[model samples]
Target: MKDPIATMKSFNRQFQLGKPEIEAVEWAWPQEQGETMFHIINVYTKAAQFPRLTAESGYRLQRVGGMILGMVN
Candidate 1:
């Protein structure tokens, strides 16, 4: 699909150290089909601000009897 949203959602892969999963998406611009757009995934923008937010949430590291909690995803 040529749709940017679809391409982004299809990218369910690890990015860096945190293994952050993009569960939800919110864009500042109106997303219209067949409309040319410029998308930026950067720390300066909210679309790319998930990592810092998740980190600040203070998720606990779960350790049990060989059952590790997966924060990624």
Candidate 2:
């Protein structure tokens, strides 16, 4: 979790163009399982010649009774 901006910069370097400009980064704990999560919002330039806004989130959850439960969008 150290230097998240640096991580985003590295990720943007992997693309030739249409690099996403970070808008915001939010940290939250929405579950009782004590898992840390992060949400990122950004805007990508030159995507189909138009700027596109996007939001992404990442987290890890445990499995119960051999069933994995999580949500992604």
Candidate 3:
């Protein structure tokens, strides 16, 4: 990965707001504690797909993952 934050931002950018399917998926996720677990799964999936990611990029992903985990906690 070039930049994890950038990757996440790009992923989010691709997200279509106001799309009922996405909203429904989000709503389907379990509340409260589930968000952190979900983001951890997200980061793991990203890492598995992009194993050659740069150090800073990986760090950024972990950092963001941590932030997400914190917020969800």
Q: Estimate each model's TM-score.
A: 0.31, 0.28, 0.38
lDDT of 1 by residue, 1-73 (tens): 3665553443323231233334323332233233222232321133333444454321211111012112222
Q: Which pairs clash in model 1?
A: none
Best by lDDT: 3
Lowest summed lDDT window (length 10), candidate 3: 24-33
Clashes of each: 0, 0, 1
**lDDT (CA) for every model shown?**
0.29, 0.24, 0.41
lDDT of residue 34 for candidate 2: 22
lDDT of 3: 0.41
Model 1 worst lDDT run, 10 consecutive residues = 60-69
Output the TM-score of candidate 3. 0.38
Ranking by TM-score: 3, 1, 2
lDDT of 2 at 61: 11
lDDT of 2: 0.24
How accurate locally is residue 18 in candidate 2, as Cα lDDT from 0 to 100?
33
Query: Where does candidate 2 clash, by residue pair?
Result: none
What is the TM-score of candidate 2?
A: 0.28
**Backbone clashes (count) for model 3:** 1
Instruction: Give the runs in model 2 whose Cα sits over 4 Å from its true position.
Output: 19-73
